[model samples]
Target: MFNLAAKPFDYLIVGAGFAGAVLAERLAAGSGKRVLLVDRRPHIGGNAYDYYNDAGILVHRYGPHIFHTNAERIWKYLSRFTTWRPYEHRVLANINSKLLPIPINLTTINTLYKLNLSSEGMQVFLAQRAEEPETIRTAKDVVLAAVGRDLYEKFFEGYTRKQWGVDPSKLDKSVTARIPTRTNTDDRYFGDTYQAMPKCGYTRLFENMLDHPNIKVMVNTDYREIVKSFRHDRLIYTGPVDEFFDYRFGRLPYRSLSFRHVTLDRPQFQPTAVVNYPSTDVPYTRITEYKYLTGQTHDQTSISYETPCDEGDPYYPVPNPENAVLYKKYETLAAKTPGVWFAGRLATYRYYNMDQVVAQSLALYSQLSELDGSLAQDERTKQSIVA
Candidate 1:
């Protein structure tokens, strides 16, 4: 809408997701700097983008983004933009013909095996079946060591293979380690202290965060297309690290996802928010019912079946030793590059949660604000929040 050459921006931030939006807000409002935020996609929220579907039911365009975090500061930082709807996410696994709680809880074990076991007995059952690995190395080991062969075959093996496009044994231990095994009947997906969603939705939350006059946002635009036009003091990149250098060390392997959204005539589709389909025979890994996440009462429910693929917008950086080594090469190049800073999951090549990304952007802002001699006042303001 305005002439790009007329004014120079204080920062050229690539990607209008959590990382970019947070920095743009901080630089503009905190240090009074002009920011140009750009995204290849036509929206600002990145993977967390949500909107009403054809059925008039709100749905996440990317997938189900359940916000949960243990860090109080991260929670407080995001809270400033949008009010939250208190929600604790719960997931179930659809194996055979029954629905069982995930994270391999006591209820899940008892239901799967048709054995009644108390919390203490549950531990004994698992302990007897668990095979302790002398060294835990890979994702398969993480599950095998915790639950042994039987549970691993049914619950984890196929699911991880389907999602990552590799056997769990070939992936990093951090992959399956993210999922926990419980002796208690507690079946909640995440055990974070704060679990909720933005009251107005993530897109609105981004709108509020980037509402500052100093931040100019342009969607459907790539940095390379306008790199020669707009002049800036610094660059903040949140895109894939490999692409930034034009894949010099070869493109780092990433896992992409495709969603098949189906709006049915029925009111409710599934019992819970998400139902994990761990069977490799099925193409989809999981099916999410949007009403459970949005809390919207609708006569027809919306369903999203997620299928992981190799071709699409990169959703996950493949976690393996080879890929990690390749990412390190790019990391080295990134450090050598001047006037550029890399942040967020894609740039760092770590599978970070949304709250973690927000925390990282906030930390970067603190670092930049200190360099600008504004940390002292900002620190005082930060401490005022009780949680």
Candidate 2:
């Protein structure tokens, strides 16, 4: 804990997640400035935190977070903290009592209908069944425009509904756009150039990132409680922008998730790390096996079942027209608020993947560095005038 009576920090970062941690590290290490980082949660790494369970297997507490990025800079920046384990994530959807490859690839289509369609044949088949909307507006439109109703119903519709607690037709197209339809037999979930996980786990990576002398971390401490006590030149807030403003423009809607973790006395449980239950009959959206993700050869394996809900910790920002309008108002307010900068998924009200969040944070750091340089130049100019 940092003493208030000590010299004031250069930055008071709220939320010890990626955004806050990245900024804290950059401001402290890069700029030689003091930074105090705090989080409401008791630990670091935010949702990406992983720990050894009773079964001695490493598992993500929030869910399975597989890091993949096309950005070389982002990948290189994170590599400083921890070594990498090359991992390509694959997902299987339980449809018609069979586990089929997700992303609606050629193999998925062929396996589903028992037709060995070539790549060209798969494209032709999709084209024949595709429905062109007048204007592609919603998640449903994105899918129907490519694969039509049958595949959409089987793969996305119910799973999306359960995941977001809303119908695909009501959500933004960006929601479904994340999942691509491959004409080829590529079964990998992400097509990024770099796909891997931290070899030691995400928590240790965060620990390395925050292990600088200039950084002071306080976990299980909310920023609101220390706002009056802590003294800092600027604020880097990574919490919900709506809540930070006290919901002056009304609360922004968010979809939360409940995770149920179970340990099984087996070496392996699932073929893949993740399996999606797209059927509406299933209560949970997906199940993630830890051994598959971590490559842990444990006698007992751990798995997590995700159940989406309206309450609990905010995970997904409800992406719809109405919510967008509301977030825009808050965004406008955020721009005018002095001494405070917002970044990350919650702060920006966008669904960002793990690597995307890191990229955003690194970008934010660059912006902050430029701003600081400009401020210092202005200060020097004023001193010259005074002289």
How much lDDT does candidate 1 score? 0.92
TM-score of each: 0.95, 0.98
Misplaced by over 4 Å in model 2 are 1-4
Residue-pair clashes per candidate: 0, 0
What are the C-alpha RMSDs, in order, of all predicted structures? 5.6, 1.1
How many clashing residue pairs are found in candidate 2? 0
* lDDT string, candidate 2, 240-291, tens digits: 8899999999999988889999999887788999999999998999999988
Per-residue lDDT of 148-258 in model 1, one digit per residue for the tens? 889999999899999999999899999989999989988899999999999889999999999988889999998999977889989999999999999999999999999
Over 4 Å off in model 1, which ranges?
1-6, 374-387
Model 2, position 8: C-alpha lDDT score? 89
